[model samples]
Target: MAYRKVHQIIQSHSSADGDGVRIQRVHGFDNPHFSPFLMIDELKSVSPDDYVGGFPPHPHRGIETLTYMLSGHFQHKDHMGNVGELRDGGAQWMSAGNGVIHSEMPMMTDGQLHGFQIWINLPAVKKKDPAQYHDFQTEVIAEKTLPDHSLVRVIAGDLTIKGDTVTGPLQQTGVPLTVADWRTQGAANISACLNPEYQTMVYVYKGTITIGGKHIEQGQLALLSEGEGLAMAASDAAGVLLLSGTPINEPVVHYGPFVMNSMDEINQAIEDYQNGTLV
Candidate 1:
């Protein structure tokens, strides 16, 4: 019956990346508090100018990028000879182990592009593994509808609610984590059991929601205290992302798009990228 409490609330800030694409970013910035999770970004815009530029080809190493789209479409092409499409209600996972060069571009000219991109840290053991990429369609993701008309989409982990358990499709996500999109159509409360050892947090992207009686507004990331479960309440329609994962206790040295265990490794990554062996 123990519920988690809000430990801290960090507001997302506007940051431009990928050829002038404006995005709201929840930065981790080598902070130990956000261990295993490096960053979370929300790209929500109806204007073509806001997102049309898209993400150009870039190299990443020692990390994984998990992208979920609520609307619009994204075409992904990578140097690994992989091409994928992320449509509305779909998701993609790309593990830049060793290294990989890729780009994500919008397929529409005028429409809503609402989505999230989360960066996860790869442990030292898996940091040098071969690169992997997978695209999940709308139907592959597990979804649950509550009696109160609330909807839940499991993106990367297991979700337990009222004795019902739903496991997501990404079983080998390089780490243990839980990510879900919770949309409440009306005033309702959703509480679910979670692993006490996992560091749990929630990101509110639409309307407002309360975690353990503390109000979390839009674009806010609420870090939660260690507990057996999470209790969140919303007054009306709201959209939130539930994130929980096991902490990776290791040195996180980040340099641009590359993350490593030490500065020397970071330098090596840079050298490799410059030498055109990044892929």
Candidate 2:
């Protein structure tokens, strides 16, 4: 396995959306090569007027979305007839195997609204599978206290440290995918062991992080080559999103919202969605 230096650093930008909601896109709509992991959006608001109203109906296909809430409350409804609410520290994971229509809106009583939405890609073989949904409350996720008392949330994989294992919701995706969330109080340093065969990356969400002697600030993403995991140290109180998965080495053909291995596949996906055959 080879280790490569951080290649790019870009700040997330804000964009206006449905019902006065503001979304800061961290990735996607730009880089198309980040297979497996596609996009991330950080949404925030404080005033009731700014966040009480939220996103309405939308459509998705050939992707999986993970929504993590830091504060306030939001509810999701889908065409498949599924509905759920997410509060502080809650997460909603939806697999849009072939196609699905859904909507998410913030429900505010009197607090701020802040959260993130991350997109993951499915392998070609599973792109046509049925859609599914899973919601994890704050208490359902695995949390571990580090040696320095920092808290780490295991969202979807395993992390081993000093003979102790921290596990998250285990889902079999046919392809290997690992994702986790970490929060540090004050200053702390921690390292995660990773499989040498998997491609990995980290996204800074709240504060600053130094990896391989390079500092990354909030909203910037770092792509890492296959190798020994990552060594991260927080300069202040911070939070980070860690993701790793088996690389889809095949050629990628993406258009609008669909990702396929070839142009023919892309055309077929579009036709299926239009013909009401993709679901």
Candidate 3:
């Protein structure tokens, strides 16, 4: 086992959406080959005015999307006749197996809207499965508090804290990928010894962190490689999300929002979407 340091750091900023949404792409744009994990985007809004209208209905395919809300509320509707609302600390995991049209809008309320959307690529075989949705309220998520009061929420995968497996919305996948949201305070440090066989990355939401003596601030993304574990310490209170997964070694044929193994597959997806066969 080897200890690997953060390989890259990039800051996020607001785009042209006129909304207060800032995106920090941890691994998608730079390293396209990081399989199982396609994209990571952090959205932060101070008030409803900043993100009221929300993202309109859109289509997705060949991916599983995880939406974790830290604060505020969101209502979602999909073409599958599914509708749900999530408050603070809630999450939604949707598998856009074949295709799905959905939209997420912030409820008209008082405070802010903050959350993260992580895109995980599907294996070649599972890409054509029927679309599905899973929603988990904050209370339903498994949480573990460390001796120092650091809290961790297991979103996907097995997490053992102090010799006990913390339970949450667990998704069992043969491909080997996991995501956890961690919040800590004081001079606390939380470390995880990840399997070197998998690739890992971390995105900071608030506060600052020191990894391998390098400091990463809010809105920054860190990509790690060739490591057994990650040693991270917070200078002040902080929140971060850690994602790890095994790489899919197959050829990735990606076009726009659809990902497949071959050009013909991409064409088929397009034709299906156009022919109303994919919903």
Candidate 4:
């Protein structure tokens, strides 16, 4: 298999979203190579003051959102009567197709509050489709244990190692995507492969890891060049998130929480949201 090279490294910038909730904004509305995948927000806070005020109600269109909780609790409620509670190690996926109004509120008062929220864009063909939601508790999500006591959790894609396979819970529709988290123990290496044509990148969340001969530390993202597979080695205990997607190669116009093909579409989205049709 041809191994990809780390072409670019991006450091996260701190930003606030969801009603004063602070987070490390990794990538949003930037980096075209990460197409189909728009944003990656890392929320890690131990103080209740940093995460208490949650998103009350918001409208999103022409995109999909995935929230994975590491140590905190998040409750998701939508206008469609879907209520999902995400605790530690749990995840929630929402497809805001044509449009949807929802809110994600943190339920933790104290202790460790950490997780990630990822935004994936929808192609023009599927932008007008209906919205959907998929919620997964901690135990229901698929996970794999490597020989080195490392762990890999599949959130929306299938992963296989040494003839053992684990498939994620969510079945996506547009521009087939893969999102998984990998944890490696000291000096442990794991083998992984992806489609050569797909846009692939890795985000280091904890500790340090080496990918394509490049050392990546926490709070940084490594954008990989075209390749089929690679070995992810950790000098110390490390955790990383693997993200890849099939490119749509279409014009992406993003405004606030809406992503569409053109300015006209963006305007239409705004009109829909303003008219209370975004549900």
Q: Global CA lDDT of candidate 2, please?
A: 0.76
Cα lDDT tens digits, model 1, 1-279, are 788999999999999889888899997856777877899989989788988789999999999999999998989999889999999999999999999999999755246889989999999999999999999998999999988889999988898999999888887887899999999987978889998888888899998999877999999999889889888899999999998999999998888899999999999999999999776
The full ranking of all candidates by TM-score, starting with the best, is: 1, 4, 3, 2
The lDDT per prediction is 0.90, 0.76, 0.77, 0.86
Per-residue lDDT of 1-279 in model 3, one digit per residue for the tens? Answer: 476688878676555231444444454622644566877767676755656658777777888888888887778899989998988888888888889888887653355667888888888888888888878899888888887898889888765554567656857553677788889877688766666777877888989988898898888878776777677888679998888888876777778678778889889888988888877
Structural similarity to truth (TM-score) of each candidate: 0.98, 0.88, 0.89, 0.96
**Best candidate according to lDDT:** 1
Best by TM-score: 1
lDDT of 2 by residue, 134-219 (tens): 78899988888998878888777677555577888746553677778888988998777776766677888889988878888987
Record all residue pairs in model 3 with backbone atoms less than 3 Å apart, i.e. clashing: none
Residue 56 shift from truth in candidate 1, angstroms:
1.2
lDDT, candidate 3, equals 0.77
The model with the greater TM-score, 1 or 2, is 1
List candidate 2 stretches off by more than 4 Å.
1-5, 17-20, 28-33, 48-53, 263-277
Q: Which regions of candidate 3 deviate over 4 angstroms?
A: 16-33, 108-110
RMSD (CA, angstroms), candidate 4: 1.3
Every candidate's CA RMSD: 1.1, 2.6, 2.5, 1.3
lDDT of 4 by residue, 1-279 (tens): 798889899998899987899999876475687876888999999888887889889999999999998888999999889998898999999989998999999866357888999989898889989999989998988998888899999988766666566789876757787788998777688887776778888899999899867899999998888887767899889989988888878888889999999999999999988888766
